[model samples]
Target chain A: MHRTIVDADKQKLNLNLRELFNYRDLFLILAYRDLKVRYAQTFLGFFWAFLQPAATLLIFTVVFGRAIQVDTDGVPYPLFAITGMTAWTYFAFVLNQSGNSVIGAQEMVKKIYFPRLVIPLSKAVVGFVDFAIAFLILGVMMLFYCFSPSGNILYLPLFILLTIISALAVGIWLSALTIRYRDFQHVVPFLVQFGLYATPTAYPAETIINSLPDWAVAIYYLNPMAGVVEGFRWSVLGGAPPSDFAYISFVLIGILFMSGLYYFRKVERVMADIV
Target chain B: MSDIAVRVENLGKCYQIGHAKSGDFRESFDSWINKLRGINNGQTGESKEFWALKDIDFEIKKGEAVGIIGSNGAGKSTLLKILSRITEPTKGRFEINGRVSSLLEVGTGFHPELSGRENIYLNGTILGMKRREIKAKFDEIVAFSGVEKFIDIPVKHYSSGMKVRLAFAVAAHLEPEILIIDEVLAVGDAEFQKKSLGKMEEVTGKGRTVLFVSHNMGAVRDLCSKGVFLSKGTISQQGEMSKVLSDYVNSEAKINKEGGVVVNVSPLDKEGKWLKGTFLKVEVEWARNLFQEGINFDFSMRTVDRVKLFAFSSEKRPDFKDLHKRSKITLLIENIGYVNNELFIDVGFKYVNKDSYEALILNEQLITPSKEKIESFLRRDILVVPGFQYIIE
Candidate 1:
């Protein structure tokens, strides 16, 4: 046998991106399967993506806009709610689906050897398709409301990319944790539900940051979704750009993403056995 | 030098077998104490770690197909899992020179909602096959699996046999450098088993290394050139397939040789009775002797409560019996007509100090009447009777 000593200081894992690239067709097929099975028997099919955000916007606009009397900064409450809800819904969908992806594909994990990251990554990609459809609806709503955005809308892709990265970062950590402790599965949805209000999904970020102490605003901005929501709103609506606190949140998101990927790789080796 | 393709050194794996149900309070208390001590509290009292394979070291050269044969709980599966990287070793390491593909179980990578065509790509990808390679071999896989008509249907709708066929086809066709299969061939029907074995033969013929685990000795002999016999998580023997198999079987037979009497007899008749029309009692007697000396002996038998059933002495022998010593003898009555009820049959050998007896050697219990038919009890064909062997050394 060809023996090579494994150096402790050197990186043990050589993630072959080429190998993953070679399996791109398989990844696409899996992502397509997830999308197909999801809307297979449903009458609305892809429209359900837009419908979920639209329906949630209607409910939140009535509750927070009319009942709670939250300010929308001269934008129609429905339009504002739909835009933020679209991003939040994609985040929630990716979190929930990718959190359970490994467990859902336990058969594949236990039987074969593949990059375990493929399972969660495929779910994230499928969620992106949903996000795109919902974002289309938001674009139509923007047109109907006669709210023309400035040239800053070109940065919208960057914000969308940020939302996906954050979602995948948390998703990788959750997927790895859920394989061992099934309690994380129950904890994830509850966290997502509570996170809707915690982040500025329905209300403007300035409403919370302006009213709270500087320390509290800094602490609140540490949540990556806060930065993502604000960044998305600024890019799409050409409204107020994120302040220094949001930059710290961007740094925090990068750290979580890297650490989550590292932690996921470490746990990926033992998942077949422990799972 | 041997063309070694796989080398395993000091490889060991430990598994924690946890009780399915325990008191929640007891479990929590154990975890709390473990956490305070700063030990790994997550792996606590719910488990007791066991080394399935310990310090195992071996090597296999290129193009050598090895068979791992073992009894249940003999760590064969654990060894395969370690080699396949299905689980990491607790304390040890190994090096495999080539790409390893494992078929631990059939249909392992098949997604139920995906179509057969879709699953071929999915399973192939998981087996480490490239898209172009899968596309090139797609038709061959479908043809081998024999599910061309239903390739587009969801796999959940496929029969289990169909799924197994497709799974095996995908795995066997993938053409990995090293293949590890663990008892997957046991699931399919006989025809399919033959087909799978043929495919395995073809795989090995291509000069790829193969590690196969199975309990079927016949299949091991047929398929593998080298064999490793595992017993209680250790390699008991390793060599040519026939030699290792013989050693394994002989060791097992010798281990099971204690506390039993063997008798050679004709077939038993119907109604689960032996010698239905005969009236006779048969007794076998023997004594362990190291010295070849002349010593007269007598054989006797009795019921459980010391009621003598039959007795015989050296004088009963017709001729040439006086010249021998330390001899074993058997008393055979011509016909045992019927066993009236349940009885414990004992046999004893008389010596100078005391007579040692084989207690409760045989329980002649009559089940139902033998009057119905004689064909059943007439089929009692005893192949070998070690009880009749008189040991002189």
Candidate 2:
């Protein structure tokens, strides 16, 4: 027999990893469900995943590479833009999906008991699957350009991991906040929209680095995705590593991750009631 | 201690009623930061405290099936939520000495795009069944739901009844040590409901504890050996199943406002105390055959001098559906603002598919409670208005 106690006054803020591990199958099942449902009724099915980044790549290449002629050093503008978009798209998707995850599972939250973190965590995983497909397209593009493999390519995994962490960090806070203040839902799409340009997605980061003063550059990298964008380009296109300013991105991401987790845990207890 | 499967001590759940009239972003954001900083000073907003479950205490020994009986808003569902760990209590605590699984609704976590087979696994996991256990019971669950032919098809195509059957099959197959169910068996047809009840009985026969909440007294009498009756968020009676049930039925009789042939009355709040500003829901039953196209029932309150005060109609309300044969419906009066006067209920029915309902004999007479009786129920010299500063003595 297992003993369970429920006390309303006692809040369980501890991250109970053992309980999470016990429900790991549920996490996998939810992630699988999200993946299957995304393309279930679509006409193009899984191609839609590749089509999103492809469409973005086309528009960016035309606007920035052709019309404006944004410098990508010597690397092809399409290759550089796609590499950055692939990572940025993953972060945006995770933020959008995970942010609405609690509201999406409103019925389940009120009915049963499971680790609530699983809802947002599963969105991150689903977003990663789409990211993986987009990355494969980049690999094909890399080969198409006859781009030689660089040793910096090994750092690619580290940057991907950073992108994943950054996405989950923002995702957790938005998802938790959306439950109490429905105003946050309206805020998400705008964040993702404005965030695309805010991160150095379509244009080169070097343009901002060389043009801005040292302190101003440091302030720009405070956006967690700033480090992610610069690191990803360096890993894929084999440029010099991101400047000292990139280290600010790491500090910003760490603070964001910790605060997001704290805010999520605080609001989690009242979720079933408000949701 | 070892013999007890569940023990709840002074358990309570409080909800802050009424949305704030005017809230600013700065106020909420401040509280949010304070919450994150782990500094809870308990000063947040201006909402009244409504104790949904207050000082609710009970115990169910292992292998015993306990029935929870209550009227609408009697905290039955809130108690189940706390027991299921879906929500936290605002006060007190409870302990359970077994693997507990609750069925508050059918197909809670099911996705419509998933096939019936996949939903079984998905829902089973939500109810806390391991993958291997679901796999072992896969064939039995499919056969029980009677949806073998459409097992691989998306559940969107399945009829609602078929969905209920499939969901109940998975939940019934779950082999938890303690099973908590809330009004889910009310779905599906009579035969399926009977089968589900039998499945519940079988679970208890295997020495598992069961906590059942239902309005159907017949089913509760058949399955549960002990009973708890909740009224206004507190227990009013508990003992042998028959005794507790009798107490509940007898208490309803004490609050019956009238002896009318047209309608039966069941009070909503305890002893018919309708707090100001809160909606009062009265359960009414009448013969369904009297229902016709454009047939309408209206509840009116009038002064003793025959002057009408207010009239509410059932024309737009959804609960007025299925008023054929014998039917029970709830009439919700949104706010109880009347003060310093005793108002009586006058129910009138009209059967009109035409322009005028004036000539129709709505009802032979009005259904009004005794004035003295209402005064005794209120037990106060002055009626205090909600959201106003006053004391009832």
Candidate 3:
């Protein structure tokens, strides 16, 4: 006689990665759809990705480099601004788009059942594709300026990963919140626009750090994007790095990532009903 | 042998009902006040909690196709949502031994901007089909959906019927271990409905479990071997489809008054007034056969203000005669009086059908009459008895 054992009491929600892995092709397709639709009919196509950062670089190079006279660690103002804006633009775009993923796909979510995580995750993945296009533009600019990447450029991938993780952390939180409060839909665009100036996206962090109190500086280090921007500059430029601030930023990003995941899972089960 | 494929234990879902009036300023003020109280008010004003599904329990074995029948707001959709894991139950537990796929709404997972071909892969993925599995069945899905020429077009451009057909094709082709469908098959034309039913029958033949919810009794009887009747968020009856359906019909019959038929005249309103004349009267005649006894049905009509509009019986008519087998029964109204105020007219009919011992009654609102147009009331066919045939000279 064969006894089939069933763990009746083992009632817990398990993250079934195997199932997610099986559906990888679907993920790729959806991500590809996002990329294609975004640029399909536009005149600029992928050039829009580069143009945005280039525009920001031009403005920052004038205002911060000339007017404020912020030191860019001996790098050209345009180069400094484009490098930071490239990374920041990708982060901001991913954060903004992924935060609205679940609510934006309300029709799909209610009609079919899939791992809800797939929606936001797919947005993040597609944002990376855009980031890659923009990154190529940044590479061309680096070549034009005769700037060569040093050994520290090897760590650029880690910084890129950090930016994605932080974006996703914030994305998941906002995605879940947006389902219940549709006002978040209106709030996100403004938040992203405001965030660009608040963070060191258009200017170097040193100018702002020098003017702040020590306690305020400590608090400023808590902004995960601060470390991200500083780290990107250090990795790409291979100059002095904000090593201590980077560690704090990494820790803060990790905490944000985990907490965002927890809140997202908590609210995920109710999304269909509330949405 | 415990062969249960599904076990639902004491499942319940609660929803908050808001009573916000349909205007802007009042609703916004109510919402603001509620927010000020820090109540996280689910909605605005005079709110009440409703149990969409309460303490529901049932079990289904493998290969059983159970039909859920209910009127609107009867919690059928809530039950399916819980079963499909689209939403979690507020209480209790349910377990399934096999993979479950739900067609809650056809074309739900489809993105309108994407082509039908791309949507198929996207929908297949959402339904948990592997890429290679979808690839193998790709041609069959397209063929079954019958949108071969339009498959490359963006679904946003597809007709609503075409969208549903494509969606249903993807769902049915996947062949999940358990399928939960919720009235989405009602979309598309009649031919497509028939084809979809045939496809569903083929799916069930493979011994997969199916749960179908629909209001159409004929379709339920034809497709489902078992039926569950839900009333007020509870299962009122469950058994063979015939028995359950009979129970549902019988229960509905009891809720409606037996000797009263209602006629709604709201559809006849014209330009804020009624098209009919002031005085209105209604009569119902029930007959069996030429030799059989004829029954005089009593009816009454009233305005929304509780003013007696008219009350009469078929017996009061001068031409009334005993109805026999194959005899013509006519109900004629005489001397329709006048009206004073714009009012809502309601009519009721009471009689017993020939086949049953219980009296059957129905009531409906006739028309909304304004005070200015009280003088112009109309007399129309409240009920057109379709089963009667006449012999011409």
By DockQ, the best candidate is: 2
Model 1 per-residue lDDT tens digits across residues A170-202: 888899878766777888999899888878878
Overall lDDT per candidate, in order of appearance: 0.70, 0.79, 0.70
lDDT of 3 at B111: 79
Cα lDDT of model 2 by residue, B238-294, tens digit: 879978876776565323223232333333455554444444544455444545555
Query: Which prediction has the highest TM-score against the true structure?
Result: 2
lDDT of 3 by residue, A68-186 (tens): 87777788877777778767787788778876788778887776767787888888888886688668767888899999988999989998898889888878777876765666777
For candidate 2, lDDT tens digit of each residue in A1-275? 58998776776777776887899888888888888888998999988988888998999999999999998888898898888988899999999898789999989999998889888988898887879888998898899999986899999999999999999999998998888777788999999998897789888787888999988888888778988988988998887788778889988888888888878877778889887
Q: How does chain B of model 2 score on TM-score? A: 0.65
Docking class of 1: acceptable
Candidate 1 chain A worst ten-residue window by lDDT: A2-11
Measured against the true two-chain complex, the DockQ scores of the candidates, in the order shown, are 0.28, 0.40, 0.37
CA shift at A269, candidate 1, in angstroms? Answer: 3.0
lDDT of 2 at B76: 98
Residue-level lDDT of model 3, residues B1-393, one tens digit each, is 567877888788877666442223457576888789886847566668799988788888889989998777899999998887777777778878777788887766677788999899888877777888899999999999999999998999999889988988988887777888889767788788889888877877778888999855556766788888998999988889877876775465323234333222221233534333322222323333313345443444444324454554555443444422332333223223234332323322223345432234432223323334333333343422212221211
Error of 2 at A145 (Å): 1.0
List the candidate 3 regions with Cα displacement exceeding 4 Å: A1-23, A66-69, B18-47, B254-393
**Tens digits of per-residue lDDT for model 1 on B1-393?**
547778887777777678322223456567778878888846665567788888677888888889998777889988887777666677677777777778888766677888999888877877777788999999999999999999999999999889989988888796767788888878666677778888887887788888999765556766789998988888888989867876665454322112333222222344333354532323233334421233344434333223344444543444424423433343443223323222223332333344553222332211122333334321123221112222221
